[model samples]
Target: MSSSTPAAPITGAAPSSLCAREPHVPAERLVAEMVPPPRFDSVRFSTYIPDPNQPSQTEAVQVLETFAAGLGGAHATGAGRRGFFGFGRAAKAPKAPSGPRGVYLDGGYGVGKTHLLASLWHATPAAPELKAFGTFVELTNLVGALGFQQTVKTLSGHRLLCIDEFELDDPGDTVLVSTLLGKLVEAGVALAATSNTLPGKLGEGRFAAADFLREIQGLSAHFRTLRIDGEDYRHRGLPEAPAPYADEQVTRAAHATEGASLDAFPELLAHLAKVHPSRYGALTDGVKAVCLTGVVPVPDQSTALRLVVLADRLYDREVPVLASGVPFDELFSEEMLKGGYRKKYFRAISRLTALARDAKRLVR
Candidate 1:
């Protein structure tokens, strides 16, 4: 058996002398000082945890953590200080996980796939860490904006990554994703992802029903694959959208400040929210930015209140807006009313449409 000793104090006093060096650590501090987190700086350690405080992407953040922690040798127990992401070191470093490490999370719309993917992103630790982006288009879009080499470097830059809602419904995206994944995975990055499809099935226009399978297999081979099967947690039905609209707030807020006409929209919204300090869920695109005010499917909400008010005010002031959504003017007609809940739905839809009518002068 080995014995442990307290660290000596920083004082210059000699050990065992009159001012004999006091133990470096106080008895009170010993408990904390005794435990070192399981992983080192190079390797991250994490466990499944509820989303913390306020999140930029609520569901996505939590789901991602659960997936990455699943990769751990032993489920991470709450312990000492963890690395930046809190993911423990790989049972083995750099080596891929046994069986499969990739998860194919597919289901009806509304399942927390995005949330799961986001959590995985938070749990990953890359050198500079890979940049986390939403949607499949973003993967290749990065290639377009930064070029293939830089994109590969970005993925290589971080060993951990999560791509939210991957697999676009386009052949162009398919080609880019097919190519991008091969290079990114080959570059030594570990990826945990979520999609709306089963393994081998890619969402591309006119894809070789069979070759699509090959394309996925190509990527899946680079990492292990698991299907996150379950029901869609996202609420959906034959009618009206959800309120305060937790999901739509992000989407619509994106529409509010997008484009050249509303150049001052961001500052105006920020200043307007000075007293309240609202979380408008702004999405950053390098230098370009878009707030989520106008992205909501249903316009009634206090969530993106500031942005919506601004969008409405902008329209009143003749600030041309351009976006894509079924304007309430058209969406809530007698044809739509035939479907029902016209009262509550119409109020929200009309408000959103009014913003569109004001901001998007040129049919968004």
Candidate 2:
């Protein structure tokens, strides 16, 4: 496969290498790609099969449906008043809604929070352009790429904004996103987010929770917390992840499979450092599967976090991960897993395991 190309065809030839590709995502593409990823593109409240044992799952759906309905009424009645931007100065902004302006779905790795969040996005009555959905990392990256004020101006027009895997790992990001969301709420944008941590407890282990809370107090107050408890739906009754395949087997599968990328795990990790995390999604564009050899535990916190982002993008695209060496569970060190970023590492493991399961057929 040619290293110059972004992706190669499946022609029983040597597969493309992720390490060889550096994707450049234009700012507009970032904004345009803010909708739910392909995996949850069609998820809706009706399609979400809530665990019969978890009543909060069912309640979340009902509340979100009502929330969607409320947005419909507001949009229908106020459409004419707000010009092109929902918060134009021609008309005085209506009083901000009383009570929480958003819903925060707090739970573990796979309780279908994302499914429900996307369902709410799909349920909202506004046009597709009027609703935005993206991960916390993506949101922060957007602000970084577009500048803070511009991001606020761009999203302030939306009727609903759904943020998945909301992160409080960085103090700066917490303050930035909090202030941005506060602006959007004042403009009447309905907010919804899903996270492993609750609103009040966002930065508990990662940083000083007290300072984080103080910075985001106004934004947190706008969110109504909904706790959904359940086991990871992905692995609820599934068998344990298959053992890593041999390097030769992974390489052979890469050569035999169409639209696959072959890379040494360490080489790919090094390549990730050269490219911005915001472009990770674009890096996998047109790639059907990922095959990595010599997979081992990540060396440090920064690398592990980068791997988590890559794992997320690959999972979002439903790309099967064929890897040799360590299993997904061992990617992070024990200390790393017990640290503040534990939830992220665990979520990455769960997602990568699911993708690994998908790759089993490729090897066969």
Compare the candidates by lDDT and give the number of the best one. Answer: 2
Per-residue lDDT over 1-364 for candidate 1, one digit per residue giving the tens place of the 0 to 100 score: 6588864433221111111111222222211211111111122223323224424234444444565554434222223211223345433343433344344555433344444554454454332223343434334445665666766665554445566445544456665676777665544345656655554655433345455566666665544344444332322222333222232333333333334222232233345545221111112112122222223233223323344333322322233333433333443346334322232233334434444433332222
* lDDT agreement with native, every candidate: 0.39, 0.87
Q: Which residue runs does candidate 2 get wrong by more than 4 Å?
A: 1-11, 74-93
lDDT of 2 by residue, 208-286 (tens): 7776667767667878898998999989999988899999889889999999999999999999999999999999999
The best candidate by TM-score is 2
| Worst window of 10 by summed lDDT in candidate 1 | 13-22
Model 1, position 323, has a per-residue lDDT of 40
